[model samples]
Target: MTAQRDMKEKNPWHMSGMVALAVIGVIALVTLVAVMVIQNMPLAQKYKYGIVLDAGSSHTTVFIYEWPAEKDNNTGRAEQKHSCDVKGPGISSYVGTPWKAGQTLRECMRQAEDNIPEKRRAETPLYLGATAGMRLLHMKNSSASEEVFRAVSDTLQTFPFSYQGARILSGQEEGAYGWVTVNYLDNRLKQGLRTTGALDLGGASTQISFVPQALDGGGSPGNSVTFRLYGNDYNLYTHSFLCYGKDQALRMALAHHTQSGPMAIKDPCFHPGYAATKAYSDLYDSPCVSDRKPQGAPESFLHTGIGNFQQCQDVVRTLFNFSQCKYSRCSFNGVYQPPLQGHFGAFSAYYYTMSFFNLTDTSIPLDTVKETIARFCATPWQQVKQENPGTKLKYLVEYCFAGAYLITLLTDGYNFTAETYADIKFIHKIKGSDAGWTLGYMLNLTNMIPAEAPDTPPLPYSGYVTIVTVTVFLLLALLLLVGRTFRPSCFKRSLII
Candidate 1:
């Protein structure tokens, strides 16, 4: 009787505690599952659009990009949605009849218009950037360049979309934007990542750009370009080698090698079995040709391939002058370039040429590149054409020369040694967008490359959720403690009564 009385007086707190914990556990379990489900749900999405025109030397390509509207500040949301290649050549090709440049773009522009939604068309910005081809046009005949620019501009303005502008992009701008495109797409420009360098090889020019530590190469001030992105400052070293593009460089080689009285030209870069006759004037008319001989009626010359990769590299090497260095160190042609550091994104012709020989995906030794080039060069031109019948005949015929030229330019001209050769990543595209300067160009023009960090809430979504979860658990625990301490007294009285 004494033990029972003592137990009743002390109160049955254990039963209340057990019952309270059971209820709390059940409620907490349900709430946890519901919270996980809600938290895991994807955010609702909205999109915005942009369009860019890449006026390359050989062709014109139209790209349409889309990104989430609300997350414009988030890096790399923009993506290529559609691409249209103009039927005709680039605008620079219409220098003779400048107005025809506008007409050539009509088909592609129409495609862009049809692809975008009618409601979004008015707000979408359309930009056109002419690369090395236009740069050469501007240099040879500024008036002609302007007429072509104006013609393309007028045509773009006729469209329903907002015509931002049509202009020739400087080599520096090309290099910088190309770098920006790579880093942006690679997500290296995000909060804690380091940016990558960009190496762009075009038909008429090539560009090298990178962020350097203290401008390493004793380069000219003109070669340095400053950028402010995401609240970080970058001092970049860039150089655009005009007329060093594969096509013009080939022209330069032919001009240098042309004998005084040869109507048929023997090109060592081609397969030995290959032969062709190109108009002599077509080779001489370009500013890249050092030949200043008075012009005559267009004469044809035989273009045959000897298929010698080493010989081709020899010809390509003549384009660079390594002798003079006004600075402590210099790339060929007295141009200053910082040492090729970190990984590099080599796109455009770099990808085209490397991919042609299947050397792009893996990092191959320099000697292996040479061996592959040799084997490809040894392949008969007829076989190459037979293998890729549907490809543009021009690209098919020039891959051998392009391969040799690419390797030579990288190794000898840019000072990229065997150790750094593997750093080059020959990429055709990033996330379906062509690997080039167009996306970065659009980003800059549209003010999407921000110089400051975006304002964010004090607590992120995950943090808020975590805090709420912890607070809820703590409150449940406190309630259990209080209920267990006080409820037993009521139990004791009720049972006794």
Candidate 2:
């Protein structure tokens, strides 16, 4: 009996290894079957489409995606998408012709086709968008801008693949889209954090967007949006002040500084004796001598040889008055004089600072926003200043932050507030991977180059009152600081004397 019991125990131990092997074998078999099924699935059945396009001031991009399909009957979202960039001039940039802009998209599509497998390519959908470059086409030659748009549209229609309508995203849509893309990619955009805001500084404008919670618990999945056109989308309340951009600001400054009259036509003292006349003075600061008889040497004084500088100034001034009139009186034609301070630079900086606060969803201190913008613009401004100390700089440093303009335009035009913006959140940033610069970095990470829309000569200027209001507050603060510091010093000196 004892021998029989021992035999039974040994038999159980013997089967243990076999049982383990059997389980593993079953698992392996199941995995192989699943792989085969996946391989056999149709491309459309296995993927979802997702795409994003960033049409910037300098370049445009077309992105397409095909996500992996889910197993079982349940559907799966699209896999990570492919990004293709068209390298050419932006449609709205004040440079390049229309043909160049259209070529950008075509090149991008060709590159994308090369990257995608022939078998799977048919399933992908393309998405296109145009940003500030297209918006600011008027800054350049108008005919070129139209051609650029037409080319892009025509190319999209001709492509064999399906094309979604190109999104000429509102400033708010741009902000929201960016927010969604980032957050969706990164897990950080969740729950409470979903209600966040973003600032997108482009070449010509800035955009700000925030998410808002639903009024009722049963509200829809997508968040509500608001937008404005002036300046940028950030500071809706102060959107008016930021309306003048880098180019516009330059024109205004030049206009106020120029001395108009027959003197404008006369050649001033040319440095290196290039041209004595104002019209021939070098804007880029060359050392060419004037054509004056006997070779008059260039003068070492400001405004001495810049004959063209005066004309540029006059034109700029005229434009500024025109812009100001549209802004202040809402009149297409109104009589006005330029400000006497010749401090458009200071005013521009100060106004932008205030607008930063105005654009943000939070009630953060104005100085903090000012500091951020100042830092962003300071680098380039410093370069300009260092490169040419003798010449006057055209743009204020802070005004260069196109993202601020986009933010403000979206915020004010859309009526997007902190509460509304809080719905969107930024997740993670993809660096060295923006598919927008495919022509070997020909297109850097540039934002929109704002241009006027087709048939729109000049968008009605608005928001002068905000600039004036902000300026007055700044003046008061300056006067107070001066009174506190200088008066005390002056009193002490007088008493001692």
Candidate 3:
């Protein structure tokens, strides 16, 4: 009997042993199921793409953006994948020869085709948003603008992407979207953090947008734009000044100095020793200065430079009309603007011009910034060229004027004081995306940014897996303990015998 009892205990199929085996089988099953679930879950990421063509005043840029296929409505998911600058000027430049504008986009569109995956190409939405340049063209010649649009539309339709219509973005939209781009990339919208202002200085226009502490009831209602994003409401103050862009502003300044129709005039904005013959017709071609053309003006005039920063600022300030304001307050030209608020991101030409002079760092005192620009402006034209070898002559010569104009625009036109000037950060890009309206424009059109926060899993995939694995092991240990403690009656009786 003793030998039989010992044999039963030694038998692996005895009740306790059987129970332990069962527990192990359960563990194996649970582990296998867990792994299968995890593996079957969408472990690999797939992406969707979007294409936005930023048709600006100076040039056109193609921006390709991508986001996770499943998380389109999530914040910060969309990012700039690739960008191509369409060679030549903006489409508005092809007023008479509109077909050439369409041709200009072909190379860039082909590049877009190469960058986006074939699978995603068909579904990818393509959009073209023209800014100030087109607006000006439309005002000057509506028929020519329409033709340009039609031509651009025809060219875009040829691509496999889902071509959305091309149209001009209003100044308000331009300013607001630029604000969105800056704040979105900063992740401020998602987290419900304080927002940053956006200052976009384009070739044909400039935009200022920000959220003020309070909206004055007496302020101009036209300047206000409200949006509900991520369960938060934002009241934005945005304005785009027409004919206030760097290039346009330059024309205005030159127009101011050449009112007498002189054969030669010395411009304070340009570096000393600079001389260029500019046609009166070319200068007066734009609607900004067309009315100001001197009657019976010479065909061309000799333009010379004196390199005076203070005088250049005085010249630039003449363009702004601070004389009248129907509203509670004004920035310039009687345009209503609330008190400046929060940090500001200066982009596009603001970044480019400041980057050229190494004045992008806002930490540098306002006086120091002025001193630096003054020094550059005072530099002789030949010396400037020699210092920047291989640089385009047209752009290089204009930097002094551009620099003086920027400082004056900020301080005099926008009313940014020396203390407040430090709040401005000259940024061309934030994270990987360009700090412009294109991404924001895309996000708005696609509904990629949800009005409310998106639902998310309680734990990350890895954390959940670890917890599940640990829980399974713990359950198995408890099951084994129970199995050992409560043996079957038959087994107990056998042991007793």
Candidate 4:
């Protein structure tokens, strides 16, 4: 009877049953934790895309932007994926042969098609926004502008993407959207940081946009733009001066010098020894200087260079009419302007021209910049060409003029003084995206940037995962400790037997 009782106490089945329960319980707990984690885990990441074509005065650029499919409304989430520069002048140049404008986009469209996934192409939105060049073309010939747009639209529609019709963005729209692009890329809009001003210098126009420290309700109504972005209200002072772009301004300067139809004119803007015969008709073709064209002018004129920086600046200043203003303040040409505020981003031609001169660094004193440009202008044309052999003669010869014009436009026209010059940042791109209006245009059209801030998860994914893992480990350890504490005496006896 004593042996039977001891055997009952030391039953191996009981010990084994207890051990089995602990193991099963641990397995079940682990399985349940894994199931919870697996169910909550994010799936493979997928992306959605948007395309914007920046059809500026000088050229056309196709920008491909993409964002996570699940987080389309998130601020600063959309980034530039790829960009292709169309190989031709802007679509406005194709007015006489509008069909050719459509052809210019083929290669770039093909590149965009290849870059975006086939499945997403159908839903991907594609938009084309023409800037100042088309504005000028539209002003000159509305019929031609319509034809060019029709041709461009027809070509864009042929692509698999969701084609939004091509249209000319207003001067105000151009400036405002450009401001949006700069601020958005910098993550300033969502954070409500002091906004940066935008200065876009294109071929046919220049835009200046900023939020003044003191709101001037008394200024010209046409110059003001208001926006509600990321729950922040912004009253922007923006103006686009037509025919003030570097290229058009250059034309105006040349027109001033050639008033008498002189066959051989000395141009201080060009490098010494530089000479080119240009047609009078070509010079006076644009609306900017067409009225100023001297009657009975010769078929062509012998354009010659004298290379004088002071003279060049003097000539550039003539383009701006500082003679009269009806407002309390004026930038130029009788245009109303409020007081300048905050840091400014000077892009497009501003960046390119300054970059070419190695004067993009605003830290350099204004006087030093002028000195460097003056020295560059004084360099003989032959020596200039020899030093920069790889550069195209067309762009190479114009550096001197562009530099002088840039300085004059900022200081004399926009009233940026020597003390305030450092505030301007000459930038081509910001965080991989070109600093321009296209991204903002797309964002506005697609409603990608929500007016309100997006909701966020209580715990980050990594934090949740770590907590779950730690919890599971702690639970298993506790179970093991309990099993040891409550373990049957039969398990030890069975081992000894």
Per-prediction TM-score: 0.79, 0.42, 0.84, 0.86
Task: Give the least accurate 10-residue stretch of model 2, judged by summed lDDT.
Answer: 337-346
Q: Could you tell me which residue pairs clash in candidate 1?
A: 270-305, 271-305, 276-303
The candidate with the higher lDDT, 1 or 4, is 4
Q: State the lDDT at 412 in candidate 2.
A: 33
Scored against the true structure, residue 17 in model 3 reaches a CA lDDT of: 61
lDDT of 2 by residue, 409-435 (tens): 323333345444433222222432331
Error of 3 at 267 (Å): 0.5
Q: TM-score of model 2 relative to the true fold?
A: 0.42
Candidate 3 residue-wise lDDT, 1-497, digit = tens: 77666767665566776677677778767775776576556544667788999999989999999876554334436789999999999999999899999999999999999999898899888999999999999999999999999999999999999998899999999999999999989998878999999999998999999999977837577788997665678999999999999999999999998898999999899989999899999998898899999988899999999999999898988999989988777899999888899899999999999999888999999999999999999999989999999779879999999999999999998999999999999998889899999988866765743333434455677977787787678767767755675465467666667
Worst 10 residues of 4 by lDDT: 448-457
Candidate 4 lDDT tens digits, 98-139: 999999999999999999999989988899999989998888
Residue 469 local lDDT, model 4: 82
CA lDDT for candidate 4: 0.87
| C-alpha root-mean-square deviation, each candidate | 8.0, 28.9, 5.6, 4.6
Question: What is residue 96's positional error in candidate 3, in angstroms?
Answer: 2.7
| By lDDT: ranked, best first | 3, 4, 1, 2
